[model samples]
Target: MPSFTLPRAARITRITRTHKIAVAVLAAAGATSGLAVTSAPDTAQAASEHAPAAVKPVDAKGQPAKADDAKTGRAVTASVADHVKVDSVAKQHSAKQAASRSAERPAVKDYPLSIMKDKGIPGSYEGLHRNIMRESAGDPNAVNGWDVNAVNGTPSKGLLQVIQPTFDTYHVEGTPNKLTDPIANITAAANYAADRYGSIDNVDSAY
Candidate 1:
């Protein structure tokens, strides 16, 4: 290796070069610091612009309220409750109507004309039926207070219009004592007619 020594001017030149490099480095650092300061606002502005907007919960219809979104579920429950109420009311009304109709049915259908024949009453069914129609219109509870038989205080009553005394006198065996008993009244009246007039079929007027 050859021994070397720097000239004074060369050394000075080298020192000057070093100084220039340091200045340049300082300048670059300053520039970088300035750039950082200037870019801070821009970075913040960019982030603000690109950030997501405030969001709210949406319904199926895209409305922003949670209550509106819950309405569909609420409607299903409400509809079922309403339907149940309606069905209950309808059933109650139907039951009431059926009971009313049953109550309103006429009581005349309780007995039939064939019952008279089965009782062995000696009378044509038509004549007995007509007599019943004229006296009580087939009403089992019919009573007569304005007739001559009732003026003596023992009123005529029941389907056959038999007075109390007559009912008691001619009442047939196996028949009820009550003058208002339909089958009993008919049997007693028929017995009375048969004893007096030979047969009920032979008499249609008051006995």
Candidate 2:
């Protein structure tokens, strides 16, 4: 007797069922839930596995693990190096500014003793200093005898009692007051005494 054969679709269905059964058997041996799991080697399982460690930061003294390292929990060695460079630049700039300011300011040597001596009269400064001390006590605005002109009530000004005519003769250059300024009056008085009395020693007798 001859046996009956299934159609091509029916044969494919039978093959698919056999494949499914085989896969299910394999999954049951080594599967966890829906995932196929594999176990690591004994050596690998015993080895430490942790998060990547941060490098420690150093201080100015080259000591490892500084305050910044503690705060940020990161390596700040590069940042510390940059900070040093910035500080150096700032210091150099400050020094340059100080030097520039010093150069811009007026120098003490610009004013000289020779200039004062050339404009001043010799041998009369001491007498003038003494006379002014007695008369006005070196007061710049000292007035005497009220405001009379020629007779006896003439106005005496500054440290020295310089009259208007005498002030016109010996007043210093660039001065506002010929007789009202102490320094100018003193200088003018000295020059006048040097001319008239030949020295300040004879000025008291004339006065």
Candidate that would win on TM-score: 1
For candidate 2, what's the RMSD? 14.3
Per-prediction backbone clash count: 0, 0
The global C-alpha lDDT for each of the candidates, from Candidate 1 onward, is: 0.75, 0.65
Give per-residue CA lDDT, model 2, range 7-101, as digits (tens).
Answer: 99999999989989989887775476435334443555555444356666566556776676767744565667788999999999999999998
The Cα error of candidate 2 at residue 167, in Å, is: 0.7
The clash tally of candidate 1 reads 0
Give per-model CA RMSD.
16.0, 14.3
lDDT (Cα) of model 1: 0.75
